[model samples]
Target: MSTFEFKKNIHLIKILNLKATNINELIEGLKKIPLNSVYYHTHRFLKQHQSISPEPPNDFAYWIEKALNMKKLSEIVASVNIVEFNKLWELKNKYIEVIKKNTIPYERKKKCNKNEEFVFMGCKTFIIPTGDTASNLPEFYEKLKIIESSSIYFHIFESRLRIDSQINDFQLWLNENSYSAVAEEIGKIDPYNMTVENLRRKILNIIEKHL
Candidate 1:
């Protein structure tokens, strides 16, 4: 497999270790990663691994299990008890059983190639890369990416980056995830033809419709 197969962190350099006493703590603990880091990873992931359309992703639990090299933890997560329980702490308890000592920490890597994108399991925050044309105009893009309250914000960010990258990431992600119909409804925007503000408006508009 290529090095690209694994998602790497590049935007933010702060490495955080998480140990949760409660669901609230867990939520806050995960938030330390910062918006820039979160955006970086989400964009990079979408760019590097595009499928045809979007769907629910099996997020952090599985990634952490793999990154930490915890086979047992992964096996438990794969089981369907998650279907029966509906509480955050209920789910947290299962994970805590494995990492009570907090030994499995992954470093937030610094300085990935501009050609390379960030990946997350993941973190909170939206990050614009130095190379993103929109990022050049922080006055506009910052307001767009900072995003006060919206799950679709990330979706917008991912779509924006996918369109901006001018690469095959989104296509692969869509195909891999089996989200074919959604792509047909969406028109492509060439990053080359777009100005920073135009790009921002384009993605924000696209995400808004979905939200």
Candidate 2:
């Protein structure tokens, strides 16, 4: 059999209401819609409501309520021929699991770093000569390259000079080239003084020099 001929069974499309309770039964009902119609409807739905959270319903009743609010459900039902809705249901369940597991870790990391303070420094701009020498450096060099290329001024005072030569080179280059470099270093503070708004402002000021 030809490759195309080997695939005889085509899945139908089904647009479900976010609040459907009997999801398994609903998936069965969608087996009549075409795959192409389902794909198009799903794309349109996502484009229109990109901000909707991917969380699963707490109960069947909740699913029913969500499904009712889906504006494109009818369009999906009419256009697509769905062979199986089980895969879609499984996919959504997996997404919810991932979100739940990741959310806590992300929030914890942000919270733990709340008391951290960093200084604003003048930015550096230089094209790295690409060759074998560049390839052997640590991954941190790639991050530095991105920061240098995009930033106009860096938060200098917040940064500790790990290498004396680097500090000297920066001072010499700025003076010799006559490029403006502005920086302010804030002293380290306790967690009580690390307000979120202040941190945001400091970061914005650093970014503004680059633009």
Candidate 3:
């Protein structure tokens, strides 16, 4: 990722900021920023760092992170609506479906137009999408701009849903742990003498942590 270049051209900047103008002016303004700066800023703004998961033996998390990072990278490349980059958009849509399906023992294998597999992932495989390496970077970047500024809000909603899903998973784990502990305590009690007040407190504590 590159650094964000601060522009000295106030008029160009104003034009870029104007919603009434065509995006060409904004693209021109963005070009003034160094390539490295633009790359770095785009990555940072898109929250690329949070994409990675530290968990081992579940490299899907890591792969998903990288795929999302690549999406961000692609957005930077196309600088227009990502849908304008048909291949990238299609790949991204498929990847999202794969994630949402959460299927077991599934794999994603990428085949070229000639039917040659360029990237393949098994049940535990981690594969990053790669294609169109020879495409113009500036054009890609333009498509990314459109994606970043898209008004449809699907991406934003998807991100929020992912967060909610994580929270739910954590809650389920806590419940499982709490139930195990409660079972242990019940085993020590006399017939019909078990109390749930202690378990309730533990459950409350878990809920509080999430809140």
- List where candidate 2 sits over 4 angstroms from the true fold: 1-21, 49-211
Sort the predicted structures by lDDT, highest score first: 1, 2, 3
lDDT of 2 by residue, 1-211 (tens): 1110000111233433321123333333234333333233333222223234542212222222344332233233322322122244333333234323333433312211222211111122232332212111132223233343112121221111212222322233333433334222212221112232343345345435543
Q: Is candidate 1 or candidate 3 better by TM-score?
A: 1
Lowest summed lDDT across 10 adjacent residues in model 2 is found at 1-10
Listed in order, each prediction's TM-score against the native is 0.24, 0.18, 0.16
Comparing 1 and 2 on lDDT, the stronger one:
1
Evaluated against the true structure, the overall lDDT of model 2 is 0.28
Top-lDDT candidate index: 1
Off by over 4 Å in 1: 1-28, 50-62, 67-184, 187-211
Candidate lDDT (C-alpha), each: 0.37, 0.28, 0.27
lDDT of 3 at 155: 23
Q: Per-prediction RMSD in angstroms?
A: 16.3, 23.1, 23.8
Deviation from native of the Cα of residue 21 in model 1, angstroms: 13
